[model samples]
Target: MQLTSTIQKLHERAPRLGKALSLATATGVITGNSIGASIPIWFMGAAKTITGAKIADDTVIKVTNYWINSNNALIDNILPNKDWRINLPDDVHSKGKYLLISNHQSWVDTSIVQYVSEKRLPLTRFFTKFELIYIPVIGQAFYFLDFPMMRRHSKEAVAKNPALQGKDIEEAKRACALLKSKPFTLLNYLEGTRFTKAKHTKQQSPYSHLLKPRAGGLALAINALGEDIDGILDMTIVYPDG
Candidate 1:
């Protein structure tokens, strides 16, 4: 009776104690995912260059599955109170090419999306800022993963050079060509960033759980790779506590 009473008191004082430990566990899982993220990038080029025969697609698939599974496990740990789910179709294997769009709620949203699409679908690749390419090992890994990088210019600079109009699209096309032989999923966050109370109030967003969706990025993606892609996978992620 005494031990049980003490346990109850501790639980009462820190209702979220378990959840906090779970978050730490989730952070560890993401660290594993980050390490897994580097493996393919580390070996693919060196192996291919050494052997003169391109590495088999199966090997790449295995490494990506490890990364995605670790990521999903991380999501499961941190969001224990929430009921998480994934909607996967029967044609996952054949549905190689996809343009995946999702609503972004928090920083965790990207990992959740990647975890959901990793194996059952295809590798999740997205466009990132060109500056991220200089971010030490991770940037080089992104380069290996063939994640597209772009440098955004000021309006005045663009006005000075109208020829830059189609440059972004051209870059996307080049990235698309690099992954043509293998199946892959292209991920795009429709909101483009984490939703905050400040942003929600500023935008006057209609959705209770999301900020206003930007159409330009989606439109650009559709225009560039719409023909090759099977369909758009619309994903929504919600965090009740937030």
Candidate 2:
């Protein structure tokens, strides 16, 4: 009798659940495409070539800011949610150079962060894997926009090949040096990966709220690009409920 009652309740809710899931998926896809891969290939490519990219000149800064503003408008039109908000300091300026740190939770976190902070900060860029540079359109766009593509060497890999130890950091520094012309934000996720219960249990992490923080990327950014930084933005994003 109890099993039959549970089945009836699930059957009643199935359609509602399915509809909700479908809407969520559609919303995600629209938001992602509106701001991301939908962007044209030659837009930034032409800008880079025209300016010679020797510096973040007037044209480069203008185009970059325009792209960010257009994306923000698209996000507002599509995902108008009151749940997402950012509390930036009163003195935060769009032209200020920032080292931003945040917790990694979902793939969607990047879009959320960019949308919220876009007005108060420069268009944020993260260090991407060096291999992403070869992926055609998106990779070329990232390069033109001054995103640093880094080649990280793990401890085990570095141990066996001593010559590879600091090469990655050196390469990142060389890339970042070109970004001195304009103020920008460099974002890093301290935990390095999204949280999972199974992985958490295996690692036996100490914190109830966060995974263990990794220092490699943070260290390299601070050490290599420290001199130009104006302020550090430590943003803590908390979800409702546990």
Candidate 3:
């Protein structure tokens, strides 16, 4: 708490330096936590793969929850004061199975999701590109946690190689199947990509603020986990500063 107060006071006295210090602190903490967690995740992930051990999977999720909790603590204690209003149905719980749909805006949106969902909902996982598995700590953690990794093929590529057609959907379904046995909040960004003026203008979006919604991912999730999902929830994030 003292550290938080000191940082806030610094912000009041020197805005730029405080902001820089805050960013550096956040980056260091998150990176350190992720690296520390990933070591165990990698070993357990390998064990799970080799032995099909449920305990290994559970261990990875526990580590991930701790990692997220650490980041959430940073948001609560280290950041400047601001209004962060989150509204959810009373029925939502950490043990519930849910499909969360949200808009895509910025990279920070995922962190916001983590912040809002700390104790209110189950650990959240989103669709990730399969190529991300090659990245260090964070990517490996995502893989071990069973985040649905999709390999999207462009239309041109699919057209040239007909065998690639429908492959992505099949891979996505296989990934989604991994979550059926567990409590999860699967997030789908209906906009497919982050919204930008240039892209929105190019698409001639119908809405004043949002881009066109892609139903494919949501439909895929429904097809794969429809029977297991407790509810489909919609979330809209507004950035007052933007």
Candidate that scores best on lDDT? 3
The total number of steric clashes, by the backbone 3 Å criterion, in model 2 comes to 0
Alpha-carbon local distance difference test for all models: 0.68, 0.71, 0.90
The better candidate by TM-score, 2 or 3, is 3
Candidate 1: which pairs clash?
none
Which residue runs of candidate 2 sit more than 4 Å off their true CA positions?
Answer: 1-61, 153-163
What TM-score would each prediction reach against the true structure? Answer: 0.74, 0.74, 0.95
Q: Which residue segments of model 3 deviate by more than 4 Å?
A: 155-160
Q: TM-score for model 3?
A: 0.95
Given candidate 2, what's the lDDT at residue 36?
60
Number of the top-ranking candidate, with TM-score as the measure? 3
Ranked by lDDT, the better of candidates 2 and 3 is: 3
Across residues 1-242, which tens digit of lDDT does each residue of candidate 2 receive?
Answer: 45334434544568566445545755675566545642543554565667665443445455556665666654443332236656888998888888899987778778777777777888788888888878765676667767888887899998999999879878888777656667888899988888778767877899886788897887878877777888889987777744
- Candidate number that wins on lDDT, 1 or 2: 2
14-52 in candidate 3: lDDT tens per residue? 999999999999999988997798888899998987897
